[model samples]
Target: MQSLQDALYNWLTIKVVCDVRPDDKAAVETRDFFEEILTAQHSVSNIETTKDDLMYYISYQQGEEIKKRRYPRELIEIMINQINQEPEKYKDYPID
Candidate 1:
């Protein structure tokens, strides 16, 4: 049997769905914008627009056990800004 660490080393897939109309340009742009930001660290499989929502599928190799949670766009922007302003503080951020 594989050890827990080994299992986690394998790529893990995650999917996030946003409730946005397929034809809304603003929503599409927002989703695409964030997708670019996230893809810097993870692999984005695909971003799809279904009738009711936009679906984002991504995968990344787990560096350490991270608590699964959802981050809003504003929060993400804030975190990025903080990291940029104080690189040393977040140089080892997320404590993987």
Candidate 2:
């Protein structure tokens, strides 16, 4: 089992599907993004170093619902791209 710190680190850095109408293309993109990240060399999280830094929460806010998604560290770039393309959709998010 992953620890809270592990989960938080992954959640903070991963490319999760926050808000989407559920499309195949998006799903494929997410999957591919995850795979790409998994193959990267800098997959390790420096938890000790970042313990004092400001961390952001990656979640979806639709109406009154605030859903959290657990994303892998490898998918961060893809998630950023998605957030950049859909600024309005992710207005509440700080994916920069």
Cα lDDT tens digits for candidate 1, 35-96: 55444444333333222223222233334433232233443244345545776764331212
What would the per-residue lDDT of candidate 2 be over residues 1-96, giving only the tens digit for each residue? Answer: 444444444444442343342343554454455433433432432222121223343443334554443443344446657767886875453332
- What lDDT score belongs to each candidate, Candidate 1 first? 0.35, 0.42
- Model 2 deviation from the true structure expressed as Cα RMSD, one decimal place: 13.6
Give candidate 1 regions above 4 Å deviation.
1-18, 41-67, 70-96
**Top-scoring candidate (lDDT):** 2
Q: Which residues of candidate 2, in runs, are more than 4 Å off? A: 1-9, 12-74, 93-96
TM-score of each: 0.30, 0.26
| Per-candidate total of colliding backbone pairs | 0, 1
| Superposed Cα deviation of residue 31, candidate 2 (Å) | 22
lDDT of 1 at 1: 42
Pairs with backbone N, CA or C atoms under 3 Å apart (clashes), candidate 2: 37-74
